[model samples]
Target: MDIPYTSKPRPDTGLYNAKVGIWLFLASEVMLFGALFSSYILLRVGALEENWPHGLLNIPIGTFNTAVLIISSVTVVMAWASLKMKQFGRFKIFQAITVLCALAFLGIKSFEYKDKFTHYEVWKTDGTRMTGHIEGNPMFLTKAKLVAAGKDKIEFLADPHHYSEGKLKIGAQSGEHKHVEIAIGDIKRLSAFVPAHSTYFAIYFTLTALHALHVLGGAIVIGFLFGPGSKMWHTDPDRFTNRVEVAGLFWHFVDLVWIFLFPVLYLL
Candidate 1:
């Protein structure tokens, strides 16, 4: 048998089944994100002042992504409006722009992830620390290679941009480029700016990755509605328009999450 309330409102609720369902789903989404956001606040506030990382993420890149999502939200409205007006061609154009915006956002996110993976921090037993991007693959230290170096340290070059001359101890990137060494016995810790490196990074990757997955999911649904799902417009215009409206609601929620995320994670 065909399902009831697929397009029509129910007598008791005076709302379509899908409409009620979407609202319930979004309520659950709010709670999920709310818990994570609360965790972020607790982590940030409780972090040791001196150890908290700052000015690490690229603000300009993040601001651009924020703008992209904001614009896509506008397009989503335009697409829905076009369908309501029975202007199929305009709806198609607007929806296509929405998909392109989603792709652009994902592309930028990947670049940011790549930068973090390449960045490194090293700690030595002598209480010295270094920060820079690894220039090449970190070579395995054979006993022969160690003997040839005539030193007790593993040798590797830091990315010249963050390399500094003469000075030791943890500091911001600056000064002349040079090869550096950390003795295995003297090595306290060595790692990239990955999740395991610190509490900051651990939450950073987890939260942002989860949000990105939401973006990906929204894009896939919007994509289907834009392409194969458009066929419904020909057979049942009202139902098809309702579908777009439902999808648009989800898209707007995705955009709103990023609006909160950009400032909270990227700024304060």
Candidate 2:
């Protein structure tokens, strides 16, 4: 038997089966992200004042990714509207742009993650801490590695202000960095910005990685509709349009989560 309410609304809810189903699915998504966000706030509040790192993320890159997701949001809406107007060609163009934006966002995020893994923070026996890129751009390098290599000193390009400076600033990264040499004997500890570095980074990676997965999942579903799944549009146009609307709803939720994520993780 054919599925009821595939294209038609149910009397009680006045929404098609897929639309009702997507709304329920989105409700669960909200709860999942909500718990993680709450964990972030609790961790931040309980941490020592000077221990939390700030102004470490690349705000400029974060801002650019925000714009990319916003653009995809607009394009997805236009794609659904194009289907409503029976303009299949326009729908194809708009949906293609949405998928491209999703890819651009993911590419930039991967670049940011690579940068973090290569970056390092060092605490010297002299009671000082500094963060920046170690010379040669090694990933997850440690004091033991330097000693094992029999290296006497490490050349580092260091940020002038300590991460706790609360620079409360953006785009001021132009001229405030310098190069320095650190002796292995004086090194107390060394770590990259991975979750083990601190509670702040733990939440940072957990939240962003989860959000990235959602973006990938939404892109895959929408991309399918843009390709082989478009065949449904020819055989059953109304059902296909309803499918696009449901996908669009989920895409909007993905975009909204990033909006909240940008400021919380990057700014304050």
Candidate 3:
């Protein structure tokens, strides 16, 4: 007796199997980040003041970084399009540009982090003295020249009304607005929102470090897909293109997370 041949076709699943798998994986990732963000909001609300450790961050720098990540997202899309068009050379160029953008982002972030450290803005376990000059408010001078002249005899008293107005107004009648020396020791009240060197700093360092790790991981994936080791996959052009698309999806996700984080952590 002759045995009959048997064959069974796999389900279409509409898109390629790998692409479908990646989407499902990304959905799970969304749930993960959503949970973290929710936790961040809860913790932030329970804090003493909405300002928390710092009133606000440097908005311009944060905005620049935001633009960088947004541009990277666009470049990744262009890379995917290039791959689809079978323009391998163009695909490589776009992929390389995206990676450079990622590095540039990290460079700017480094400068921001360094600024915080150098200014003693970082959190400390044991109370540490912050050494930087506090940007003085200009409106506080009563006799401006006297203060500017550094006359020790001139008395500088905090005007309660002016203080309430959040401006430093000088007594025009007084010979000159006297400049008063403010010492950290003179701070009669500390914002309950300000963490005493430890808690707030820890949160900031931890959050930013984790985000940086994600960027690093994305970089590694892109490196593998476009680097020398890619030769074997390149032999099979279709597989190589699929790999690029998968990496693009991951890179885009990383960029999206940063967009949300930049506003919540820095701007707010």
Candidate 4:
């Protein structure tokens, strides 16, 4: 059966069926992210001041990703505009750039995640805590893992200041990383900057991972429209244009979420 309002706007809403559906979906997404954001605030506000992590995230990298998303947002709009002008070639070119930007954003995010996984924080039995890198650049290193490997000592490069100690000063380079040989017997706890590492990381992963999923999803849909789905442009130009418009809306929302996320997670 033919679907009503697939190409035409509904009189009551002045929006095609797909457009209306996308807006409704975005509304639900807002509530889902809003709840998570609220939880982050509560967790940070309630946590001990000295224990909350800060300056662990790389601000320069985050800012660069932010620019990538912003550029993708502009390209998505241009893609839609190209379709409106019946410039199929331009639409394809713009959409291709948008997809590439999405991929670049994902690639950078994976690098950041890897950095966190390799980085470590250790609590010694003597009540001293230190954070930095292990000599071997291991992923998810823990006390149990060290024991299971029969390793009695690890060569560590400790950062001058723990992440919780202070914010990263502007234009300041990292201080010298002190080398320390830590004995397994003196280790009380060991963890990477993963979800289980602390409450701050838990929320950080939850928020950024969810947003990455959205970016992936949007990229897939837009990719389809830019590829095989473009056949619709020949058979039904209006419907195909509507499809691109719908995908663009979702892309914009994905970009907007990251805009809020960059500063919250990386800067503050």
Tell me model 1's lDDT, rounded to 2 decimals: 0.80
Better of 1 and 3 by TM-score: 1
Instruction: Provide the lDDT at 42 for model 2.
Output: 86
Kindly report which residue stretches of model 1 are placed more than 4 angstroms away from their true locations once superposed.
137-179
Give all TM-scores, in the order shown.
0.85, 0.94, 0.66, 0.97
Worst 10 residues of 2 by lDDT: 166-175
**Predicted candidate 2 versus true structure: per-residue lDDT over 1-268, tens digit per residue:** 9889989999998999999899999999999999999998888888887799888899889999999999999999999999999999999999999999999999999999999999889999999998889988999788888899999999999877777766453236655778998889989998989887888888999999999999999999999999999999999999999999999999999999999999999988
Judged by whole-model lDDT over C-alpha atoms, candidate 2 comes out at: 0.92
Which pairs of residues collide in candidate 1?
A: none
State the TM-score for model 4: 0.97
Once superposed on the true structure, which residue ranges of model 2 sit more than 4 Å away at CA? 148-150, 169-171, 174-176
lDDT of each: 0.80, 0.92, 0.60, 0.92
Model 3 segments beyond 4 Å from truth? 1-10, 121-198
Q: How many residue pairs of model 4 clash at the backbone?
A: 0
Give the candidate order by descending TM-score.
Answer: 4, 2, 1, 3
Q: In model 2, which residue pairs have backbone atoms overlapping below 3 Å?
A: none
